[model samples]
Target: MNNQFKDWKSNLDRFFGHDFWGDFEGMMKPSIPYINMYQYDNEVLCYVSIPGMNHPKDIEVFVDHATLTLKGKIEINHRGGHQIKAEIADGTFERTIDLPFPVRSDKIDATYKNGLLIVQLHRYISDHTRQNPVQIRHLEDE
Candidate 1:
């Protein structure tokens, strides 16, 4: 009985602390730029803080109901310009997160402007119980 309870508790912890909240607290506690979440009536929005991206359009956004990944490459010339300070990281970066609820990718929208990336996952009809389903392209063996 105790082992069963432990198993359930562990699962609950992961779902809430990691899966549901996307490990926000753990990731944000470090010396790194972070992503923020916003709640709306119809959607859940995410704001990724990515400063100094030479080509903002190069960013890639991937969303699985279980997680979201943002991948991009930035080239920063440390010595190319004079009188510079320091940066946490340079070159490519990848950030991932697990959302509180399953993302509604069908109704999702994403845009990158300024130095930040914004993603909107429609929540009006999102069903957390549903996993991403597989649909075959061709119906027959060819």
Candidate 2:
């Protein structure tokens, strides 16, 4: 009975094609780099993991008011061997992260070292947060 089950499963897999379930699972998920973020009273720090890149220039970092964007490609050298298994992803990818507070564009720093990209951002205070009084007009007075 166990052998019959195995044969039946093998036949089903063969009919569907090689790695059909794997391909379907990959399609159902979005690939993105892993990241860690830290927020301080007046600053924000972000750490992104990106391996197999030759140079820091391979990645592009963008900062908006409260969002950070990372775009890059990860390349893996096969080194002339038959690949029996592959789990690591290697390709062009873009990921955006939302920050807790708006950051100052001028006060931003980024460094790539040991396959990790570190970003330091200073918080910015917007004018809208300041105390502003609204004038109330009396129509009867007019």
Candidate 3:
């Protein structure tokens, strides 16, 4: 593969696969929410789409260094006295990721609006600390 055409490889990929069901609802339905990532000088922003959710507190966000997991629930209305029709994944949702640098977990922040959850994690500065041996004086026995 040439260096110039490497980026174009993904654009030419024409998927010719089959699913359990027909193409009517298999390839056209959007069930799970989509997520986007953005990097900044001292923080990283994650945008997750979860439309029709009423409260942001229902969602969960977990982070440890390079890994981040997001779990959330969404409620829906159905016929026959308001049932459930979940398209935004009302159960456990997870997304594990690797960050370029360490993040400051204590300073991480999150906000949700318009059914989109936006998470911001501050970056931590890596400071190489060294360890050295120290001499101690022994106490005399009683």
Candidate 4:
């Protein structure tokens, strides 16, 4: 039937345009850096792949008890010339990662090599500060 055909065409269009290769957000959002995290017995290692970002001071890395933040800007200067297209992202980017467990903020270390940023964080056992349930009392008891 025509109705079934229309539904099939719409689904195909949606899949090809937005869902395929994650183009839904790709068209709107700038390209972001790729990262991978690994956890060990006493430390956590993170690798960030950000090409075209060379300056050390341009990137800032921070770690808290349960979070790691990475902020940086990628600038690609094009000399006076005609440009057809550019897919490389060149702008400020900030990415925050939630750690699985508490980490020692003071023992965090980072290094950049071959356009890859490596971050190492030492783990520490700390008292969790999660919300605790409170007991409710009746008005007559007080």
Who wins the lDDT comparison? 2
Instruction: Note the Cα lDDT for every prediction shown.
Output: 0.70, 0.87, 0.69, 0.80
In the range 42-95, model 1's lDDT, one tens digit per residue, is 568899877777675678888887478888865555556575665444557787
- After superposition, which runs of candidate 2 have C-alpha atoms over 4 Å from their true positions? 1-30, 127-142
Question: Mind giving the per-residue lDDT tens digits that candidate 4 earns over 1-142?
Answer: 9999677767876867745434544678744667889999888899988777767788989887889888898777678999799877667889888987889877888899888899999887656854578988898987
**C-alpha lDDT (0 to 100) for residue 4 of candidate 2:** 92
Segments of candidate 3 deviating more than 4 angstroms: 1-31, 80-92, 129-142
Give TM per candidate: 0.55, 0.69, 0.57, 0.63
> For model 2, how does the per-residue alpha-carbon lDDT over 26-136 read when each residue is reduced to its tens digit?
796756677889999989999888888789999999999999999998778778889999777778899888999989999999998998899999988879775588999
Estimate the overall C-alpha local distance difference test score of candidate 1.
0.70
Model 2 error, position 56 (Å): 1.1
> Which pairs clash in the backbone of model 2?
none
Q: Candidate 1, which segments miss by more than 4 Å at Cα?
A: 1-33, 78-84, 124-142
What is the lDDT for 84 in model 3? 52
Q: Tell me which of candidates 1 and 3 scores higher on lDDT.
A: 1
Model 4 quality (TM-score): 0.63
Q: Assess the local accuracy of residue 13 in candidate 4 as a C-alpha lDDT between 0 and 100.
A: 67
Checking candidate 4 for backbone clashes, the offending pairs are none
Best by TM-score: 2
- Could you tell which candidate, 2 or 4, scores higher by lDDT? 2
- Per-candidate RMSD, Å: 16.8, 7.2, 12.9, 11.9
Q: How far out, in Å, is residue 102 in model 4?
A: 1.2
